[model samples]
Target chain A: METILKVKNLKKYFGRVKAIDGVSFEVEKGEILGFLGPNGAGKTTTIRCLLDFIRPSNGEIEIFGYSSRNPDFYKSRSKIGYLIAGSNLVEQWTGYDHLSYQEALHGESKIKNELIKKFSFDPKPKVKNLSTGNRQKLGLIMTLMSEPEFLVMDEPTASLDPILQEEFYKIIRKLSSEGVTVFMSSHNLAEVEKVCSKVAMIKSGKLITVQKISALEGKKIHSVKITFSEKVSKDLLVDKNTEIQEEIPNGFELSVKGEMDAFIKKIAKLKIESISIMQANLEEIFLEFYKK
Target chain B: MIAIIKRALRDRFIPFISYSIGGIVLVWMYIALLPSVQQSQVQLQDVMKAMPEGLMKALGVSGVNLASLEALLAMKQYNMIWPLLMIFFIVSFAGGMIAGEVENRTIEIVLSSAKSRAKIFFSKYLSGIIYLILFVVATTLCAIPMAKLYGYEYAAPNYYTLMYLSLCFGLAVYGLSILFSSLFSSRGKVYGISGILFVAMYVLFILVSLKDSLKNLQYISFFYYYNINDALIHNKIDGLSVFVFLSIGLIASLLALIIFLDRDFAV
Candidate 1:
């Protein structure tokens, strides 16, 4: 278990506004760590600090046991790839020109053509002529082509169509399987949950919790819907973690916080026609953290 | 750094060629017309005699003979047309260099690379200097062939002094443009602010030249050191002038490097 990146008490402030207030996290090798937060939740800020695109107001980031601010970090940089949201490419040149240029910078590419074929974007067309999604594809190729061991992506799949998004996921899956580490930020909870080994939920520039995807199972509440054959008192379920959310003529929706086995057995004793138990998604879990 | 220079060159190369063509036209028009203008020199001098003394001095034509090909070409080509072309070239180039990248959100990608901000800034600045030399050399080369074809009358003008002045003057304006570019994030604002500053400086230089009491203002105006006709016609390379312009360029670029390196890139 190699700890490739370590960020400690990171704080970045714009004037008086603390963009990221004392965020601390670590990413191990070959793991997909999802940085989950809403729009201004310091996700991009944290990534920018990690990449040294901007200096942190206070704190430090270690990349591969070296300070991220090290003058020789370039040696480590060759092992890292990043895809920026709304990438800026030379519009006058074709996508291949950008690919060749970046390849030259990072040395010869091992996966350039493979990623191109996988993403399916025209490399011959001028960048100005490429669609937003295609430009995103070109950006993806530019970053992934070097076959870097680590990837820091900021909403890499936002502009792509659903099919392309799936393609991006497949590529990430393949990359992760090959033992490449990834640190990505996304408000796309389902996609993050589907692929991320672990998630760090952040709100208002503070880390709420870092949980394994499975650990979220009982750590947060799940919403449950039950329809009874007849009107019944809310007391039919005796579990304290379960509370009726919306009452219906014949059914009620309950928010269940923890384990539901006790609540389910109690509800089963009462004649229930049908029951559907729904688990809270990552976004809901995040909202709960915000409330707390 | 190499990648960035390639991209910057890709962006600036076409416009540079077009400007060179425009420069060629100006150089050819002035030099190719020199022989004929020399023939009408007496009449032209006569026509110039009636002009008011104040107007002549303001136009920088006082004590300058329109009869010599050197004087006429120096006034028309070196002082006015060539500098104008160089000003636009350097201003737009410097304006777009880093500021353009920042505005387009492209600097983020470039910054993500292993290169330092200083590396990026210096590489692009060096390319601009190369372009400046090429542009100035091209114009001078265009003039030499045409002057030979047209049989330039006066003693072959000092090519070295002309080139030196052009480089110095180019550096001066280029420095201001890059400074403005580094100061502003928006590409258009870079151009707009530098353009406004250039015009203001040019105007101030004119007013300072016209008013004996306001001559001290020349210290701030780049156009003050950009006396190309004085440098060419007199064969006088002012060391102070060269130092001032080059220093302006180097100092401005230094400030740009400092600010660019230290500033947080919002992109």
Candidate 2:
């Protein structure tokens, strides 16, 4: 597989604050890599470094075989698109003016009209008068209109409503299908789980893990609740990776990690009234990481 | 490159027109009073002779005949008021080009394109130079046609000299503005630093005029080189003055471009 983006041991320091400390990651062609982190976890810093907006104090970033510091990196930039949270659009300019300006810069965008229609954005209003959601929509359109081969987005859907977010996800999925590589940082776990093929989680300026979505789900934690017509001891279903969270009047709320085969087998023998099992979402998995 | 320049000028279109119109009106108002001032030249000369020589020198009107239209315009218009307005226009124009973009965070969007930073930086600087050209032409050169309208046969060559001096002075200010804009992220900082520096230069020019000991220090001030009285009255263009202003402008603008190309945009 072609390595579309490669960042090795990237470090950015603002005085004593290490915004990103020795972080390394790669995204292949057509891969949608979700960068997940809490606020101040250096997600935006990494994105800025990748796009040459801010220089990393150490290490290197290469996109399409051009080091970020190389003059030729600008050639690669023509094929890349970026969006930041709460984009700074010119307040006095109408959406059309921005589109015209972008067109002037990157040439005519083939999907400009389609994206505008899909996002339901009016192109006549000045940026200052638009709602936050509408502004985000304009930003999204600006980033995607060029149909770039690579996208580096920082919380691209941050201000979108759920419906618009879903639409954005669909558009991203379509782009990915057409072999567009994407690296997006987002705190929305559901959005990542819905659209990303793999996830890179960072905490306190350090990347803790990068794994496939399936691998993440394989380690999913399950919350199980069982009710019994007759009282049963909590020790009955207790096993490795399974802990009793709380004991209720009739049963116990249990936390089960990893495979639940043994716990299910034990529950099948004695559940008299009702049993409920819930799979943990990515948020839960990340919360555990945060706790650690 | 053209797009960047176009957008910059478009963003500042309103201010550009306002300053040009304001300058025209101010010059026209001074011209309207020229006839009346000429009628009272004898009385004005008496008052000028009675005033302290240092004060008159500080005002750029020392030992000059008030009867000449050149002297009247130079003393009344070019001495302080026009230059102050010109500096204000250039500061705001050059300041907003880079530092303002960073402060408002629009630089991210501007840099989002594939254009090189050098292209963007020079485009903005060139646009400012372009504005400075138009500004000097409108404010200073327009005096000829304006004087013609008032039936005053002003010397065309002197006004042309004034235009050259004004353009060079403006380039120096624009250079300073761009330099400050490159170093600072905030537009207000650029305005403050550049403002204070030019104000200090003006004060230095005044102090040098008032005190002989400080006269040796006058060469350091840009206002010292902007000899409007000499340009208008003698119809002379000082080679040293032009060289100083142009060299500062070239060196400062080149420094600004170098700094902009190297410095990180943390914003």
Candidate 3:
């Protein structure tokens, strides 16, 4: 796939605070790249820099093959749809009014009705009267209606109800299927894992890792619960790969980090009646990554 | 640029109407009260004594004879009322121009569009000028009947000249406020600084009018542009004052545009 966005050593500072520090990443065409980071970990700052909302203190960003230094660099932004972290619609205007204003700005009148229906938003209600979920839906509609090539959303599903969240993912998936590149930032690992084929983890303004979802599946750690016939001696369970996570009267739980074959065989030899192994979920993976 | 002007008009039309009507009413009421004060046969000195110094200063009373109805009207209404209205409308309009977008977080969306920041600034400033013209026209129309009712035969030329001077005053204040709006990101700061600058200039104009020693300071105040004593009462427009006022607006607007083009917007 061709690279859609290339960010290298992107750094931004506000006075003494380094908002984005040496962050590097690339987004490929037709790829849903998930940007996962905790609060204040530079996700929003990175998106802002990408959108040219704020100038970077150091480093470079090239979007659609144009360097940010070019005077016409912002023209490339027209191809990207953005939903900033917070909902900032005018309170006095109805949803329809706001959408119409934005449509006028873009000089497009084709997608109004389609987007209104797609997001299931009530156009009659004022923005101040709309609930958080509906407000997010309005923002989503505005961004989506632009028919942009890439969607750069900062915590797009935040403040959304579970049902709306599901609906949003469905829309995102639909867009991805249509060959629109999506760069979504979120703190929810499961949300990103559900929609993204590839994920990059950022921590404290620094990128920790960028890996494919399939690669992470292979790296999955599992917990094994073994029920032995008798009390297993400490000598019998002498394996460094499997660490005891929990101890019971008749059984013990072990977290297997590496290969599970040798540990499973050892448990079988110990006259274990039953054993259960479950793959660690995304939440656990995030915790482990942060713990390290 | 047209789009920006349309948006500004849509947003500020209500405030513009309210202020324009309020100005007309205030001027009419002040004129009506003047006849009553005159019917009571109160001494001019007594009337002046009844008014506080702060009230006179705030009302921009200076140089004109209070005995003549036209001079009284010029001092009480034309001299300060239009200037106050011009400053209020321009400052309030300008205070909200860029700062309102920042407050609403819509600046990002606007900046992301095909239009450049300079275009946006110029368009909004031009819209402010349109509103200012509307305000001067509204006041001029309302003042015509009031002038006839008071039997002031010279009101036509004076009112026309005052409207022209108000336009110049509005342009200077509008440009100043736009400069303030671009310099500060916060709405409160923009309003506060612009308000203080306006009042400070008015005070300086008064000081220059009160003392010959301080008369040179008139060059510094935008209020000098609409000096009714020289323009309406004396029936002579100070070409120097008009030139200075227009130059200030041109320089300030250019500065605002330059700063707007280069200044980084907060996300």
Candidate 4:
């Protein structure tokens, strides 16, 4: 895959605080990458540096193979759509006015009406009158309407309701299908799991891991429940590899990691009647990653 | 650059209209009432006596023939009306420009556009110049009829020079205020710093007029650039003062643009 954005030893300082320290990552074209971190973990700082709104104290950023430090680097930025962490809109203008101004700035004057209606925003009402959800929708419309090659959003779904959140994911998925690269920083693990093919975990301005979703799937913990026709001996079931989490009268629940084929064969030899396996949820995977 | 100017013009039309119209009406009323006050012997001397010596000096009223109708009109229009209007409009408009964008978080959207910081700064300054020119033109139009009614000779030459000096001084104040706007991200801070600086300079002008010991401070105030008596009544332009004020405005605007280009948009 072609690289769309490249960062080398990116760092940012706020007064005495090191907001981003030696962070490096690459976003590939046509990839939906998730940037996962806790609050105040330098997600927004990295995005700001990428957009060239803030200069990096030390490091380099290359967007579409152009240096971000150049004064004319902003020309490349016009091809990018960004929704910052907070909803920042001119309160005096209507949602339509904001979008129109953005459109004019991008030189995309003939945006389709269907595109505007997709977000379900009332263009007539001023931004101050809109709720947080509606305001976010307005930001979403502004970012998505240009149909740029890359979408850089920070916590894009934070203020959105569950239904709107799903709708937003649909749009993101559509964009990904159309080969637009998306780099979104979010704490919502479930949302990330739904669309992102790759995930990068950050903690305290440092990158912890960057792995494919398939690699993370293997690391997922599964809860296996087995029922035997007869009572199973606890001593025989005791194994260091597979943890026997709980023991019932006729069944046992075990939390297994890695490949469970051998563990399932062991259960098969024990005259099992019914067996059920459930993978760990996204939140559980996030917590387990953090715990490491 | 044109786009930026267009945006500024659309956004600032209301404030421009309010200040210009209010200025013209106020000056016209003052000019018309001056004749009536002059005809009544009691009102003229009483008004002159009540005017404090410090106030007269602060307003730059000295060595002028007050007996002439044109001189009194020049004093009222140039000393009082022009400065007040110029200070209020430029300070208020410029104080809100950058600080307001930061407060509203619109700077992010603006900077994210295709335009550079230099372009944005130039466009904003251009818009200020346009507003100031429009004000000068409007005030001239309003004063023409009143100048004729008052039987003031050489009214054209007097008001023309007055307008020129006013424009130059107005640009200086606007440039200073724009510099203040770029330095501070908060609206209150910009307004406070700019207002205090203006008042302090005016106070220095007053002090310099009071004691010969403080005369050295007169060079600091932009107000010193204009000799209302010479410019308005005698139609004499001080080339050196104009050069000083223009240089200050140009240098200040250039510094402001450089600072804006380097500083990050806080929003």
- Complex DockQ per candidate: 0.51, 0.64, 0.47, 0.47
After superposing candidate 3 on the true structure, give the runs of residues whose Cα lies further than 4 Å from its correct spot. A84-86, A224-277, B31-42, B45-63, B67-70, B145-151, B205-220, B224-226
Model 1: per-residue lDDT, tens digit, B109-180? 677777767887888888898898989878765666777777765444565677778888888788878888
Candidate 4 per-residue lDDT over residues A1-292, each given as its tens digit? 8899888899998889998999998989988899999998888888888887778999889888878777787776777888843357877778777777787677664554665677777789998899998888888878877778999998999889988898889988988988999999999888889989889888888888878777786685888888889878867766765778898779888877667787777776788888899997666667767866
Top TM-score: which candidate number?
2
Chain A TM per candidate, in order of listing: 0.87, 0.86, 0.87, 0.81
Worst lDDT 10-window in candidate 4 chain A: A107-116
Q: Is the docking of candidate 1 incorrect, acceptable, medium or high quality?
A: medium
Q: At residue A60, what lDDT does model 3 achieve?
A: 91
The Cα local distance difference test for each model comes to 0.80, 0.88, 0.77, 0.78
Q: What does candidate 1's lDDT look like per residue over A1-292, in tens digits? A: 9998898999999888898999888888888999998889899999888877778898889888778566665456767898855457877778878888787677888778877888877799898898899988888888888888899998888889999898888989988999999998988888888888888888878888888777774575778888888778877663567777898768888888877777777776778888887788767776777777
Off by over 4 Å in 1: A218-220, A226-244, A250-252, A260-278, A281-283, B50-55, B154-157
Clashes within 3 Å, all models in order: 0, 0, 0, 0
- Please report the TM-score between candidate 4 and the true structure: 0.87
Q: What is the lDDT of residue B133 in candidate 2?
A: 96
Superposed by TM-score, candidate 4 places the C-alpha of residue B99 at a distance from the truth, in angstroms, of 2.1
Candidate 3 on A194-290: residue-level lDDT in tens? 9898898888888888888778767757887878887787557657666687887688887777777877677766777778899887776676677
TM-score of chain B for predicted candidate 3: 0.86
Every candidate's fraction of true contacts kept comes to: 0.52, 0.70, 0.44, 0.54
**lDDT by residue (tens digit), candidate 3, B65-157:** 565555666776777776777777788888888876776676766666656566767788888888888998887557678867877554467
Ranking by TM-score: 2, 1, 4, 3
